[model samples]
Target chain A: MLALDIKHLNKKYEHFQLKDVSFQLEKGYIMGFIGANGAGKTTTIKSILNLIHKDSGEIYILGKEMLEHELELKQEIGSAFGDINFYTRNKIKTLTNVIKKFYRNWNDDAYYNYLKRFNLNENKKIAELSTGMKVKYSLAIALSHGAKLLILDEPTSGLDPVARDNLLDIFQELVEDGEISILFSTHITTDLEKCADYITFIDNGQIINSSEKEEFIDTYRLVNGKEEQMDSIKDQLIAYKKNSFGFTGLIHTKDFDPSWDIKSALPNLEEIMIYFSKKENLHV
Target chain B: MYNLLMKELKLGVNPFFYIMPFLTGALMLIPSWLYFLVLLYFCFLTIPNMFAGYKTQNDLIFTSMLPVTKKDIVKAKVSVIVILELMHILIAMIYGMISVRLYPNLIYLFFKPSFGFWGLCFVMIAIFNLIFISMYYKTAYKYGAATVVSITATILFAGCAEWLGIQNSFVSNLFKGAGTEHLTTHLFILIAGIMIFAIFTIIAYRIAIKRFEKVEI
Candidate 1:
């Protein structure tokens, strides 16, 4: 069964609109939601969590409608944003005591275990923790409640490389049991390369692609050719950058012709995103 | 709902606020000063600071993250305000009784600390809550304008009531002169005030919930 299924979700603001956003995440896997800043990634995640009201949509988590059963469904869904710093003066122990009471499935043992595992001190004030520790604390709270689905927005935005890698490792280990599913959104594509099982790309409030990690990357190819050779496949290229010697561009693998006598190679997640961003600037 | 209330009392409110009622209630012992300002201290100090704390600490977002409905959130916050208001009034009432006993024969310029006076205090706070809660939830994050407007409305209520007590002979007689001797009248006003408090607070809660539901967290 799908852990999350969003169908035709739409939310409009005075300045921007999310149009026909749809995606699915199967159980026991991590789907990385990738997009540039202000590309509607946060808006989509907020819509799914019901933090913002959607104009129209159907969101199902674990076979239950989100709006109809929000409280019940929230009991099973865990969410953490990278930027939230809560009640700085309150000790973690105090905060946890208040939060744990809301969940019927709260496990104290699991909570204490995560505290030890994450090296979080119960007596420390929230302000004392580093950014990385704060995210870990959020994760600890989320996991202690036996949540079946986790939705994270920009979870790795402001961490050092080592810290980011540590979080990525923790994320992979959490899904090993095949019972918990995660939908993590981040602009940092390199982090996703380490652990994301599926990649969902969004741009300009629209879904560019959503598929398995390898297949999604393989769908696009980066090609390099001389200025003269560019004319042959220029129209087919998604976007290209020209250097003094030649031009490098991105193209759909399906549209790439073998007889074009150009050098083409598989693109990384970052390369795909960069080219997609440049597509807006590409003039006819 | 109980858990949500606990969250507000424990995390949202400071310990100093819990002790503030006792400190401020001491004002009622001043031997017939303006007793309305005694409870007015709550409107002046506790509420503005408490809500400012919620805004700075981002309590709404934190509470929203929990497994509760939008309605429950409004209910819990309103309940906390009521709880605090009751604590201030009850503690001050004890002081009020003591002041009245200490000077039974003392003539008063303002309303004495009687059951009827306590009833007026309740109505004042009710108007404050009705204005504050309804306006604050429109944004659910910004409390400054709401705080200013509501406090002004409450002070206006208190000012008008005191004016009536002084200018109108029947009002002065009821509260300060022969009216103080009427137990049935005091009881009736007290009961009416309590009912108004409940009804107005429920209306505020309903209005707050509707506005908060439309707010995007």
Candidate 2:
């Protein structure tokens, strides 16, 4: 079953427009949503959750229309935004009590267990927690409510390397049961490389690519050669950067050739994103 | 709906603000302008500060993440505003009773804290409610323009009512002088004020729901 399905989702602001964006996430797998800043990653997530109204689109969560079954779907879907938008002055315990009442499946034991695992004190005020700790707190609340799907935006941006690894491990453990899925959105591509089963790349409010992570990585190759050969291959490159010693560019694997006499390697997710994001002026 | 209401009472209601009623209610002990200040407390201080708390805490964005509907959010917030207004008036009414007993024949510059005046206060708050809730919910975080506009209307109501009470002999005789001798007349006015309050607040709630439904977090 698909956990989330969004089709032709469009939203317009005075300065920015999300045009004809669409994607779907299969159940029991993590889909990494990759984009540069202002790439409509958050906009797409908000539309799926119905936090923002879409200008025109159909959104389905758990096989039901989102707007028609918002309360029902939201009860089963857990989400953590980039900002700690909850009451900052209140204690975590108070927030828990207030939030837990809305979900019938809320488990106290699970909540306390998560707090212990995260080394968080329920008595501590939300204001006192560091940004990484706040994300952990949000994750704890989300997990304790028997949520079948998690939507996270920039969840690892504030964490240290060890903490980010720990979070990825937790995500891995949750999906191991084949009952949970996650749509993880972030600019941190290395983290996605470790746990993402699928990847969707959005650029300038439009999706540029969406596929299995391995398939996506296989589609492109990183090519580096002597600087003098830059102009000959520039037309075929998605994006490229040059230095005094050499020039590097991203090319489709089908376009690569040994006859070019250039070194080639499988590009990482970060390289892919950076190359895709590079403007035409940067190619020189 | 009840859970949303409880969340407002639990998270949105500040302890200091909770106690502000008793502090402001004590102002009724003043000799002449007891009623106006008590009413002004709700307009000038309570509503603005409470909304500021919501803004600082980012309540609207956080609550939108919950399982409740936008209708429930509007219902919960309007209910809170009414509840706080009632609490303030009820507390001040107690102080009003004591002030009347403390000085049996004290001259009232504004309307006395009688049943009729309480009815006027209710209508006053209702006007504040209709304007404030309607305007504030349009954007959901903007309370400044709403508060200013509503308070201006409130001041106009209070000012007109007081001017009529002090300057017009028939009005003075009706509300504060011989008017107290007839129970049914004031009772009818009180009932009319309450009806207006109920109608205006309900209208405000409906308007608020419509405006808030369109707000995008």
Candidate 3:
């Protein structure tokens, strides 16, 4: 079963629009939503959560139509953004008490367990917690509600490397039983490279690609060659950068011709993003 | 819906606001003061501060992320406002009764703290809610313009009503003169004011829901 399905999702602001955005995340897996800032990642996430009304589209979560069953569907989906700072003066316990009342399946045992695992003290005010702890607190609340799918937007943006790795481990553990699915949005491609089973890349308000992580990486090549060899594949390159030794460029694996004799290797997620961003700037 | 209301009361409101009514309600004890200012304190202080807290705390985004609808979100907020408004008015009414008992022989200069006058206070708050709730939901985050406009409307309503009581003999008779002595007339005006309060608040709730639905966050 698909945990989430967004079809033709479109939301327009004065200067930006999510154009025909579509993707699906299978249940029991983690899908990385990748895009740079203002590339419609948050906008798409908000649309799926119904925080912003889509101009036109359909969103389905856990096989239920999102708009028609928003409240019910929301019960099965937990979402967190790394930047969310809520009620700074309120203690964690106070906020949790308020949150627990809204969910029908809220599990005290699970809630307490997560608190213990995260090392979150109930008495600490939101203002007292560091950014990583805040993210953990949000995850605790989300997981306690028996959510089947978690949608996280930039959940690792402000964390240290150790904290980021710890969160990635927790994410991997959550989906091990095939009962939970995650759709995590972040520009931190390294985190996705660590745990993401699937990848969906968006650039300039449109979906560039969505597929399994290995296939996604396999689709692009990072080609390096001497300056003399650049002209043969210049038109086929997505974008290229000049280095001290030679020139390096990004190309679709299918576009690479072996006869051209350009040294090429599979591109990493960061390389893909950098090339895509360069491609955008080149047009502008 | 009930849980959402509880969330508002528990997390959204400051504990200081819960106690503010009693402190401000004591103002009614002063003899022949512009009693309108007693309830006006709520309009001036509570609404603005509570909304500012919501804005600063990012309450709207947090609430929207919960398993609730936008309509329920607006409904819960409106319920909180009504609850606080009622607390202010009811507490002040108690102090007003005590003041009237303490100064029984004193001739009142403005509208006395009578049932009819209490009814007018309800209408004033109703006007405040109508303006504040409807306007605030247009953005669902910014409350300064809404608070200013609504408080100004409430003050104008109070000032105009009080001015009419002093200048118009018939208006004065209805609230202060013979009307105060007659339980039926005071009851009628009180009921009328309560009805208006109910109607206007519901209208405001409806308008707020409409405006808030269109809000992005």
Candidate 4:
């Protein structure tokens, strides 16, 4: 079943405009959204959630149009942001009760189970909780609500190393249920590398590229060579960064000669991000 | 609707907002002569506090993301305003009864306070709520200008009432001969005042819901 489909969504502001931004994610698969801070990641997500008005185009979640089926569409989906998404005056118990009123499928047992696991006290006011605790509570709430699709924007942000790892584990577990899918956005590429099966890279309000994770990682290779070797390779390169020591470029792994000692060292998503960023800089 | 209303109450009913009504209502202990003064004071000061809790938390964007509809959000906020207004009226009326008991034959200096006066307070609050909700929902995401507009509209309502009282035509006729002897006219005035309060409150709800439906977050 289709989880989300954003088609030609358009919105404009004074300094920036989202022009025909579109992508899709299927059920039971995690799609990692990668972008720069001002690259319109939040804008696109806001449009889908209907938090911001869009100039044109259509969005469908679980095969229902957002405008007509707003309440129904929202009921099936859960969302969280990098910042804790609740009022500070609320105690966790009050927050849970409020959420339970809106979600028909709210599972109190699951909520309590998550709180126990996360070491969250139900009576603690949100303002008094630590940042990490707040995020933990937010995720716990999201997971407990029987949400078929989880739309998280930078959920791992501001979390310590241990918390980040624990969250990644929860994400994997959530997907393991096969009924849940995550559309996770993050600058922490390492997190996505571990759990994402698909990726869609956005740049300056446009989708620059998208593909399955295995094929995406396999399609590009870091080619280290001198000027002589570089002269022989230009069109075969998709992205590159160079220094006086030598030039390094990303080439389709299939194009490299088999006779060379070209080891297939797994490139970190950061390396891939730098390549894309530099490529955009070159255009400017 | 209850979900949305509860969310607003949770966020809107902090120490500052919850206590503000009691504190302001206590001012009614001054004199029956100053009752309109107290009510007018309340209509301006209390309504702005509705958005104060929202300011402290910076919660508008976060609140909009939940499954609650935008219309429900506006309704919840207006409900809080009404709640605070009622809290003010109830407490002030209790103080009013105390003043009457302490001085049974005292003639009010400005206009004798009565049930009619308390009912008029509700009308005052309801009108301000209508203007504030209708105006605020249009440009609510805009923090500065929307607040200024709403607050300005609130103050203007008080100004218009003051202008009416200068001649004692509209407000005075309602309280005519309300001094030494109690009158059922005060009862009619109270009932008419309540009807006006209900009508304007309904108008505010209608306008707020329509505006909220089109609000972009």
Candidate 5:
């Protein structure tokens, strides 16, 4: 079953609008929600979690309608936002005691295990933790409640490379049991590249692409060529950048010119995101 | 619901708020026209400070992440406010009794801190609650306007009541003079005040619930 199904979700503000954005995360896999700043990634996540009211949409979690069954569905879904928005002056022990009471499936053993693994002291106040530790603490809480789905928004935004790699490993392990799924949102595409099985790219409050990670990556190529060759393929390139020496850009594999002496290679997730983001803005 | 209430006790409210009742209740020890000070102390010190703590802690955003509905949140918060208000009144009532006993011959220019005055305190708080809670819940984060409006209402009620009691002879006699000898009359006034407090607060709570339900965190 799909763990999250958001269909035709729309939210409008004075200057921005999320227009009919839709995506689904299948169980037992991680779906990377890729976008730039203000690209509607957080907006979409908030809409699904009902932290903000939507203009019109249907959000289903674990095959149940979200609005009709929020309380029930919320029990099985865990969410971590970019910042640790908990009571910063309170002790972790006190905060946990308060939060655990809301979940029927809260497991003390699991919580203690996470505390040990994350090196989080229960006696320490939330404000005392560093940014990376704060994110770890949030993940610990999300994992402790026996949550079947995890929706993380920019979870790795400020982590060190080692910490980011450690978090990616944890996400992979969580999905190995085939009972948990994650919709991880981040602008840092490398983290997703390391662990995501599927990818959904959102730009300007709309879904630009959603597909298996391998298929999506395979569809694009990074091409490097001399500056004089720019006009030959200017219309065909997804996005391009040129210095005085040379130019490099992304292009669809099908749009390649075989005789141009342009070097082509598989584009990484970051390249794909940059290309798509630039493409979307070019259209505007 | 119990969890939501506990959440408030743990994070939203501060230890100072719990101790504020006893401190403010002590104001009733003065044997003069300071009866209104007891109610004003609570309205001024406790409510605004508690709300400030809530804002500093980002309580609304944190609570929204929990597994409770908006209605549950409003209920829990309103219940906490009522509990605090009751604590202030009950403790001050005890002190009010002691002050009266300690100075039996003291002349009360304003209404004495009697059962009737406690009822008036209830009405004063009810007015504060109706304005403060209803206004605060509209946005949930903007407390300045709510506090100002509610404090203004409380001050007006206390001031008007005190002025009328002193200037209007019939009002003074009914509340503080010979009318004190009639148990049934005072009892009826006290009951009426209590009922008004209950009705006003209940209406405020319902309005708060409706407004808070539409508030997007």
Candidate 6:
């Protein structure tokens, strides 16, 4: 059974609409969700988590309908969002104690271990904690819950580079367990390169592309050419934006011409995002 | 539910909220404590402080992301308010009981030194909760607007209570009168107070949960 399955999910606001979003995360792979701000990435996740009511669609977690099994389903899912709001009055010890009661698989020892690992004090109030510290606290609780899936929204947004790398490493370790999966939403492309098996890009409330991480990297090629070269090969261009002197185009690697001098190119997720978002106007 | 309740106590609201009522209620003792209605003034301080964290722009997005459901979230908030209201009344009542002991000649202004004053307090809190919770939940996106609406409703409550006290009809009977040296509370009024509390709390919860479900974040 799939760990998560969302089909034809729709939600609308005054300015944004998540139009029939759907995707699945199997039991053992990580899905990176890339989107610009206001792109409905968080909305789609909220629907899957049953945090928001869907106007229409079906979502199943561990093969059980989400609406019918929210409490049970939630027990196995670890969730974090970019905006971390905690009770400012609560000491870290109290927060841990409170979360311990909700999950039967909760490990107090594990939670405390992480507190030490992260060098966080149990007596610190949540309001006094830094953004990076809050993220670590949320993660410590999430990981100790024995959850099978983690739905993290921009979990590393405010962290230092060393801290961010540590989080990515944790995700890598979690995936190796193979019983767990993650749907990580963030602007950090480098993190995706480290652990993502697949990617789905959302822009302006739409999903532009969904594919394996390796394939997403390999599918698009950047070629620099003058106007005449651009003219000769214009039909093959998957995406193109012109500079004053010449045109730079992203061609489908599958359709690339060996005879053409494509010039120097280094492939990466950031370049691909630029190419596609410009290509389809969210074409990624 | 208990887990989330504990979390609410710790992080959702400030400890000062709980302590402020006690401090304010203690102050009433200094003013001959004959001013039983002064407790209403104490309730005023709570509304803004109670909702201080939530009145910000990001609160909607932030609160919705927690493990608790929107329903539970609404319940927790209302519960916190109830706890505060209860704290104020109880502390005031305790001080009321002590004031009478300290100054034997003290006259019971609203209710006699007995069950009547406590009952009045209950009804007052019930009324305030219904109006405050309902208004806040509906106009939640507009924190300034909702605060103003609820504050207006509170003032209206104070005005209406004062009007009833002077006329001394159905409202006068609820609080202790001059004829009754020892105040008494009927079973029905207490029950009605609780029932009203339940109904309004449910209404507020429903409104908030529905609105929360539709929030974009």
Strongest candidate by DockQ: 3
Per-residue lDDT for A1-284 in model 4, tens only? 87989899999999998988888888888999988888888888889899888999999998889988888877788888776455776788877776677877788899999999989999999888776677778778777777888888888888888888888888888788688888988878888888898888887888876778877777678877665566667566767666786678876668866565433454666777777777778778
- Model 3: per-residue Cα lDDT over A1-284, one tens digit each: 99999999988899999999999999999999999998999999999999998999899999999999988988988899888798989999999999999999999999999999999999999999988899899989989999999999999999999999999999999999999999999999999999999999999999999999999999999999999888877899999998887899999989988888878898999999999999989999
lDDT (Cα, 0-100) at B143 in candidate 3: 96
Give interface RMSD, every candidate, in order. 0.7, 1.0, 0.8, 2.3, 1.3, 3.7
| Top-lDDT structure, candidate number | 3
Q: Distance from true position, residue B122, model 1, in Å?
A: 1.1
Q: Predicted chain A of model 3: TM-score relative to the true chain A?
A: 0.98
- As a whole number from 0 to 100, the lDDT of residue A181 in candidate 1 is 96
Model 4's A-chain: what TM-score? 0.90
Instruction: Name model 1 segments beyond 4 Å from true.
Output: none
Q: Residues A88-112, candidate 5: write the lDDT tens digits.
A: 8889999999999999999999999
CA lDDT of each prediction against the hidden true structure: 0.92, 0.88, 0.93, 0.74, 0.87, 0.71
Over 4 Å off, model 4: A128-130, A227-239, A251-267, B15-19, B40-45, B104-109, B141-184
- Fnat, model by model in order, equals 0.77, 0.87, 0.91, 0.60, 0.72, 0.26
Best candidate, TM-score: 3
Tens-place lDDT digits, model 4, residues B1-217: 8878787776556657677756766776665454655655555555555566576665677667677777777778777777777777777778777877776766444455577766666666666666766777775644445446655664566556545555666565454344324557667767887788778887988887887777765
True contacts kept of 6: 0.26
Per-residue lDDT of candidate 3, residues B1-217 (tens digit):
9999999999999999999999999999898889999999998999889999999999999999898888899999999999999999999999999998998886777898999999999999999999999999999998999999998999899999999999999888877776688888888888999999999999999999999988987
Among residues 3 or more apart in sequence or in different chains, the pairs in candidate 6 whose N, CA or C atoms overlap within 3 Å are A87-B11, B111-B176
Off by over 4 Å in 6: A125-133, A232-236, A254-266, A280-284, B30-37, B54-69, B104-114, B139-147, B167-177, B182-217
Where does candidate 5 stray beyond 4 Å? Answer: A257-261, A280-284
Error of 4 at A170 (Å): 1.1
Better candidate by lDDT, 4 or 5? 5
Model 5's lDDT to the true fold? 0.87
Clashes of each: 0, 0, 0, 0, 0, 2
Clashes of 1: 0
Off by over 4 Å in 2: A280-284
Candidate 1: tens digits of C-alpha lDDT, residues A87-172: 98989999999999999999999999999999999999999998889989988998999999999988898999999999999999
